[model samples]
Structure formats: structure tokens, C-alpha cells
Target: MRIGVFLVAAQFPGMDSGDVLRATVETIVAAERAGFDDAWIAEHHFMSYGVCPSATMLAGVALGRTERIRVGTAVSVLSNRHPVALAEEAAILHHTSGGRFVLGVGRGGPWLDLEVFGTGLERYERGFAESLDLLCAALTRPSVKAEGEFFRFREVPMSPEPPGLRPVVACTSAATASLAAERGLPMLLGLHIGDEEKAEMIGHYARACPKDVPAPGHVAAAVAQVADTTEQAVATLKARMPEWLRPGLAGYVPVDGRPRPATDVDAYVDRLCRIHPVGSPDHCAERLRRTVERTGLRHLILFVEGAGDPAATLENVARLGAEVLPLVRDL
Candidate 1:
């Protein structure tokens, strides 16, 4: 099983984005040394939260810094980028990571990006799906004419194309998962739902995935911090979580700009724990094992760093790779 971590690129008031950059690269190097499989850099904009903003640029950084430890966008919001740009950057990441790149596709925060890209929510939904379709076509198919509502192409072959057995495409939403399955794409789920929702979401994804997709539905289950001590993990998470990682913020924060995320940490945790995996390695591994038994997930993505001191956070990464991973790897 492949194990990866979430890099929020969380930035504090006085914090330098460069620090996160250094930490991220160092973490990937360490992950490679520790036998971890991949590093998933999340994208967020204008928030003090995970500040990657650009996955391909970071992928470039990762390529220059690490020997292995595949680097992938935890997801690149499809609604935010053009398919050509996506294909080009992914090819760059593929080259940078020695072909160890996974394309994490999603229709995330259509509200924020849609406006910037001169689109509406429904348009975002459609454009995101279509862009992913063209992206896959650009990557593998030798020649293609991708004409859709938001994007169109004719005889454009994205070269050095994902450079492999079709780059892994992990969809973020059920609708997007349907889009993926309809086109036989791999699925990557965000660990952001209740138990029933999680199960149902996976069900939809699996039902949508075609039997002919290169790999069986590739499911990635995301979870929050993994530590030796659950108590410590929770405390650290609350203290240091970036703005964007806050739970229910989207549901609460209206697009109309009404004040929201108005609740305190307790409320946030109550809602977030419903979606994220937070506990000691044993507890986390137990949950993961059960989920895999039920869903047969191909990868387990974790958010190893919390809102804590840098040293402690890195230590947590080391601990999870050294301690927690062994318990669940063979399960």
C-alpha cells in the first residue's frame, strides 16, 4: 500500500513561504529515505492555510530536490486551470519526478476560482469535468479533438505526455468521480465525510469506475494527523491548523461573503473529526484497515503535520513513517 502525507503549506503571519518550501522538500527527501511512497501538496489561494497555490511549480521544486518520493498535487482544482496548462505542467512534473507523478483532479471551491475564471458554479462543474476529460486524452491518446462547453481542442498532442501507462487521475467529488468512471479514470477520495457518506461516496465512485480502467478504481483515503499519542495529536492539530483546513467552513461561509467559519475550534473539530482520521497509529491503522477491507483503497494519504512547532511536526512525520506505517502496510 502507498502512504503519503498532506502538506498544507500553512503559513503564519511572520512565517516565510520559503520555510514551508524547505520543509516540504526536506520531508520528501526524508520520506524517500524512510520508504514512504509519495508527497501530496495541496492547493489553496489567498488563505493563510496550506499555500501551495501552484502544484506544478512545487513539483518542479520537488524534482530538483528529491531522488524518489513521488510528488503529486493532493489535487489541482480542475475548475481553476486550463487542460493544456494542466497537461503541460503534469508532463513537467513527470519529468521532474523521474516520471513519478500522479495527477490529482478535483472540482474544489468552484466558488472562489469560478469567479476569477469568469464562470459560475454550474459552469465550474461542467468545465472541471470536461477539462479532466481532455487532460486524460491529452496525456495518453495519440491525437484528439476535445470539444466541450468550457474548453476545445483540435489535433493538439501534449508531448512527453504523462510519459507512462496513463497518469493516475484521482477524482475529488462524486460527480467528478462519475466523470472519471464514465471515462474509466482512477478515483481519489477526500477523507471529508461522515461514515455513511464515506461509504456511499466510495460506492458511487466504484459504481462509476469502468472495469477496463488500467487499475481497478484507485481509491485514496485521506486522514488527518497520525501520531503515537492521540491526545498530543489533537492538541497539536487544533493549535496549528491553517485557515483553509477548517471544517464546515465551506458550508458555513456563504458565497455572498456573509461572515462565517464563525464557530470556535471545538465546533470545527466536532465537524472535522467526522471526516478526518485523527488518532494514535494503532487507532488510525485500525480505522484504515477496516476502510480498506471495506473499500480496498489503493493508497492512504495522511496529513502528518499539524499546527505545532516545526520540529515537533517533522518528528511526527518521522514517527508516522517509522512507527505507524508498519502496522498497516501489510494489512
Candidate 2:
């Protein structure tokens, strides 16, 4: 039951992107003091949705600030990136963090990421496999040489090597989750699925996982929040919270004439109640424990307050860390 802070880098009103960057690093500093185990950064780009486009670069900043906490990408979009560059950067970050870096890889998303990159979704799965295979090869052996449909590497040794968690790659979709298991990699799940989905996906990984593997397949779910009261917590979530969500989001999101996401907190809550973990400290802790217990998920990454108001969001985090996290320490 280890707790981790996943830096979603959600935007706040009147705060510059740089301000959020500083806030993120400071939050990690505070989280370390609060006795957190690991910290993760997400991969999002070309939108106001996420601030840390270069997740590894920001992770390097965290490396310089913290001494013992582990750091890595919540996901490094593998499809849009070159395998060689991904390997080199992660290796450098690993050295920067004294071997505390673990690479979380993904094939980006279905529409927004793939469409933005001008790549078709039909072969997306194949590209994901290709990218993961290439990146892993580059990280493990020196003088890498390989060729695949989408990526190629040759005569390149990933110097100095990444330590601690070693070179790990993960993807979010269920099929990809099985792929991670096939390759003996850890898996990161999106925050917006139900209990049944969690059980089934995690179970899929476990079933496909090899018994002799060093580390068994892992499940990291991204729904976390803490507030003084459940009522107050729901109040803290803003009207515009759903606006920050990607347009390519899954589920029954109907149009409501606001260009993108409209005033659909009803539709929003339909998905959110399943994905976003929010509640008072006591309830939050107990619910989180139950979710993990049900799925046996070890890595828990929390996105506090749903990301609409940063100040209120931080307040939620302060309360959550102070109360809820302590309650779940042994559970």
C-alpha cells in the first residue's frame, strides 16, 4: 500500500504555466516531507490540458530537489517520439535521479494524439509494440542495433544505464495491458474506468504474466482526492473542470454546443464517478483501499480536486495528505 503523487500539472486560473511548474516541484518537495514514496509526471502536449510537455525534463528538476523518492513518466507518448531519443533521455534522467527513474511508455491516445501526429489509429497497436520493443532494446543492451516497421536503432549503447526500477514500459488499453504482461512490463491505467474494468484488466495482465518473471505485472490507477467533507469536496470541483479534458475522451459524451466540452457535469460525472477518485479524508482513504484491495493494485497515483482550481486543489491535497494518506498507511 505505497502512496505516490502523480503530477497531472492541471492548469489553474491566473497562474502562468511556469507558476504551475514551480508549484509542481514545490509540491514534490512537500510530498517528500509528507513521506510519499514515488512521484510521476504525465505526458500531454499542444493543449492547455497539461503543462509538462517534456515530462522527463521536469522529472530531472525533481531529481535535483529530492534525495530518496522515485521519479518517472506517468506516460511518455511512445508513438510520437523516436525510440533512440526516448532511451537516451530516460537514461540521462535515471543518472540524474541516481537510478531512481522508471520509464512509463504509451502509444499516445486514440484520436487527439494520433490524429495530431498525422498517424492512423488502424496500425496504432502495432506501432506501440514496435516502439516498446525498440525502446527496451536500447535501454538494456549496449551498442543497440535493431530494425522494425516503425522504429530503428543501430550501433548505439545507452550509456551509464538506468537504475532502481530498471527499464520499464507500460500502456493503458486492455490489449496493451496484456502486451505489457507479454513483455513482462508494468501497466498504468487511465483514471476513468469502473471497478469491473479494473478487475478485468488487472486480471488479464496477471493471467498472461509469466510465473518466472522478476517483477509481476503491476496496476497503477489514477483516481485520487481528499477533502475535509464530501460535500465541501464536491463544491471544490468547478464548472469548467470538464473543459480541461481531452476532446478524444472515451464514453457517452454528447455535444452541448460549447465548441468542445459543454456544461455536462452530469455526463462528466457519469464518467468521473467511475474514474476520478474524490471524497472526504475518511471516505477517500477507505474507498482507495477498497479499490486497491479489489484489484490488488500496488501503485496508486492521485489527481486531487479534479484540476479546475489550483488553490482549492492544493488545499484538497494538503488535507488529503495530512489525513487520508495517514489513514491508509498500513492498509
Candidate 3:
């Protein structure tokens, strides 16, 4: 199994953006030193949920800092940027980083980001498949032309072509999973869903995937924290995560001028704690093993910043590598 850390650059209350960014980089470096296989960055905008606006930009920083560990985006919102521009960035990173850059793209929500980026609600709702197709073409082919509903352009030659650059798709539903499978791309499953839901999505992908294409290795995101005991790990997150999640979850504004549903912060956190690996090394290992057995996912990107403290988060990463990883690495 491949183990990785998911960096969100979560800006907790009383913490500045610089603090969050610096800690995020430090955590990535620490994760590399702790023998992690990859570091996945999250992109967020106009919200304290995650301060990093560009996952690719942060991925560049991480790739430059670490030589061995791979760097990738947990997801870059495809609706907010042009497919060609994103493809160029991915190609540059892939070449510069020795083919260690992984681009994970997602169809973002109907948030205010669409308005700010001048991509209307239609793009987020309907244009993602077109954008993804264009991106795949730009990455795989020497030159490409797009005459699609959302994008129309003459043939543009791809510079620094990334022939083997396989992008991962963030699949939150069956439609997205099928889309990814049809394209022969791996799925990056979210942390919110349980193992059964993930298994179902995997089933959907298996059914839709073409026979000629080799099966792709899917990635699963999970929240993790290592401590001396189960109670300590649970207490640490319960104390800090809610304060950070309360404002962050409530900050998203719908672009359609409709009221968004309220998220119960405590309840959400409770669910995460229950479903994820948050405990001692042995307990964490057991949880991860069960997840692998149930979902058949070998790639795991663990979210370790829920403690909302730089020192604690770093410790969590180190302990995960030192203690929990060995217990589950052979699985």
C-alpha cells in the first residue's frame, strides 16, 4: 500500500495565512522525512476551510523542497481554470519534477468561485466533461484542437508534451466515477464517504471501464492522527476541529443566490472520527486495514492537520510513518 499525507493548509482561528502556509510546507517536508510516498495539496478559495488557492502552485513548492516523495494536487477545480492552461502547468511540473507530479482534477461546486473566475454556473454544472477531455488530449497528444460546447479552439501544439502523465479524477458520485473509468483514469475518493459507498463507486468504475485499458489504482482520502491512546487522539480532534470547521463550512456561498444547507459541524466531525483512522498506531492500522479490505483501495492520503496545531500535526505525521505505517504497509 502507498501512504501519503494530504495537506489542506487549514487556517484555524488565531492563525494567519502565512502561518498556515509555512506549516503546510514544513509538514510536507516532515512527511517526506518520515518516509511518506506522496504529499497531496488541496486547493480552496475565499474560505478559511483551506487557504491555498492553487494546489498546483503549492505542489511546485513541495516538489522543489522534496527530492524523493511525490507531490500532487488532491484536486484542482477544473471549472475555475482553462483546460489548456492547466495542462501546460501539469506538463511543466511533470517534466521539472522528474515525472513525480500527479494532477487530480475535480468538478467543483456551484460556489462563488465560478463568478470570481468568470466561469458561470453552467461550466461547473455541465462543462466539466468537456474540460476534462480537453485536458486529457492536451497532455497525451503532441497537438490538439477542441471544438466542444464549452471550449472551441484551433489546433494548438503542446509544448513539453507529457506522454505518460496520468491524471486522477476526484469522484464524489457515480457519474463522475463512470466518467473517470471511461477515460482509463484513477479515482480519488473523498474523505466524507464510508467504505461501502467507496466500494460501490469502485464497482461502478469497474463496470464502465474499457477492457483494453489496464485497471487503475484508486486513491482514498482519510483523516488520521496518532497518539498514545484512542481517547487522546479523539479528544485532540474534538477540541480543535470543530472551531476550525464551524466557520469554514459556513463560509461557502452559492452562486445561484440560493441558501445553502447548514452543516452540523459537530455531527460531521463525529462521523469523520468514527469512520477514519484516529487513534493509537495499532488502532489506526486496524481501521486502515479494514478500509483496504472493504474498498480494495491501496493508495491512501491521510489528513493529519485536524489537530489544528503545527507541532501536533507534525508529530502526527511522524508517528504515522514511524508507528502506524509499518503495521499496514504490507497490506
Candidate 4:
């Protein structure tokens, strides 16, 4: 399986945006030196939750700094930007990166994005689906005409034509999974859910995928921290990860659109660590092996930064490269 680092680029309290972004670039550079296959960056806006407001911009910075290791957006929210604009930028990025750019698209935070962009929430899913369609077409063909409920374009020529743009869709529900399958796009699953939930999501996608098309590649992401012992890792996470795992972090609604069991902060943290891959190098390797075996995943992206101090995070990355990665590189 391919191993990648997922950089959240979150600006913690007391840190400036410049510091956070510089740290993220350094992390990617470090990951490449540590023999990682890829570095994925997350996009967030108007919040310290993630300081990389534009993941595409950060992708450029990462690509400029590193070679061999692929760099991509963990996801560029489709609802926030115009499809034509995004396609144009992605096409250029794909060429500039020497075909190393992977455009991971998603429909995330309809409320915040829509409110900020002054779009209606009623068209959230439809607009995103349509935008994705337009983007896919633009990436492949030279000129295209699109007239959709959300975006309209006529005789648009895709300059600097994208070659082999392998877009990955980030899915959180059965509906989104089916959409990704219908488009024959690879998936980027998040670290939020449990094994049973993941199995169900994968099954749904498999069943819904068209038979004529090749099976889509599956990727799973998780928050990971490796130390000499499990206790050390847990303690580090417990002290430093509170800002990221708050109750409303999942958004206003449960991911599955159903009522969720009420839980306190400590319970939530416990559940998150349990669901995600968090432990010593040996233990993390075994857990990731089990996850890959169970899900038939092609790639695993670990969120190895932002959950702790810079020193601790860097130590985890080094240990991951030296101790954990060797154990599972061939798996």
C-alpha cells in the first residue's frame, strides 16, 4: 500500500498563519525525505481550524519544494468555488506538477461555505455534483459545453490540457460513495468512522459501481502518532488534541444523517483514538495492516501533524519513517 502524509495545516492558538503554512511545507518536505509516497493538504477558510484557505495554493508550494513525492488537496470543497475556475487551475497544476497533482474533491461544510460564498444551501449537493461533472469533463476534453442547474458554460476550451488527471472523491456517506462510484473515481475516506461503518460504505460503493468500468481505488486516512510505547502516544494526543476533536467538529448533523449517541469530551476523545490508528510504531503498523486487509485499500494517508507540539509531531514523523514504515512498506 502507498503511504502518504495528510497535512491539515491548522493554525493552533498562539501561532501565526505564516508559521503554520511554513511548518506544513516543511512537514511535506520532511515526509518526502522520509520516503513517503505523497503529501495531501487540507483546505479550510476563515477559521483557525485549518489555515490553508486554499489547498490548491499549498499544493503549488509543496510541488515547488519537493520532487518524486506526489502532492494533492486532501479535498478542495466544490461548493465554494466555480467549477470552470477550479478546472482551469487544476489543469495548470496537473501540468506544472508534471502530472503529480491529484485533485481530491468533496462536498463539505455546506452551511459555512454557502454562507460565506452567499450560495443557497438548498442546491448544495446538486451544485457540487454538477461542478464535479464539469471539472471531470474539462480535465479530459479540449472544449466542452455545460448547462447545469448551478453552473453554465459554452464552448469552453481547456487550456494546457490535463493528462491523466486522477481525481479522488472524498466520501462521507452512502450517497456520496455511490456518486463517486458512478463517476468511477477513487475514494478518500476520512478517519472519523468505525470499521463496521467503513465496511458498509465500501459495500455500498462496490454494489453501485458500474460493471463495465474498472474498480475504483480505495484510500483510508487516519490521525496517527507513533512513539516508543502506546501509553506515550495516548498521553501526547490527550493533552494536545482537544481543539480538533470537539463535539461539533463533525458539523451540525451526524455524517449519516441520523441521531448520534450523546457523549462528553473525554468519551469523544477515547472514541476518536480507538477508531483512528494511534499507538506506538509497532502497534500502529499492525492496526493499519488490519485496516488495509479488511478494506482492500490501495493507499493509507496518516494525519501525523497538528495534533501536538511541533517537536513531538516531527518526532512522530521520523519514527514513522524509520520504525513503522519499514514494517508495512511491503504490505
User: What residue pairs are clashing in model 4?
Assistant: none
List per-prediction Cα lDDT, in the order shown: 0.66, 0.68, 0.92, 0.79
Q: Which lDDT tens digits does candidate 2 get at residues 1-331?
A: 7777888676644557788788888777767776777888887775556777888888889889999888878888787777767888987887766787768877765535565565556446568777777777777766566677665545665676633243445544667877788878777776667666877887787887888876554646565655567665554554445555533133212122223333454566546544456667777877787877788777687765364665655665677678877888886
1-331: candidate 4 lDDT, tens digit per residue: 7999998876555667798898899898888888888989988776666778799999998899988899989899887777667878888778888888888888876446666676557557567778788878877888878877876667867777745475788999888999989989988888777666777888999999999989877777887888778887777777767655452244434323446555476765677677767888888888888887777776889998735556666777787888888989888
What lDDT is reached at residue 305 by model 4? 74
Which one wins by lDDT: 2 or 3? 3
Task: Give the winner by TM-score.
Answer: 3
Kindly indicate the candidate among 3 and 4 with the higher lDDT. 3
C-alpha TM-score for every candidate: 0.84, 0.85, 0.98, 0.92
What candidate 3 gets wrong by more than 4 Å, as runs, is none
lDDT of 4: 0.79
TM-score of model number 3: 0.98
Candidate that beats the other on lDDT, 1 or 2, i.e. the better one:
2
Better model by TM-score: candidate 2 vs candidate 4: 4
> What is candidate 1's CA lDDT for residue 320?
74
How many pairs of residues collide in each model?
Answer: 2, 1, 0, 0
* lDDT assessment of candidate 3: 0.92
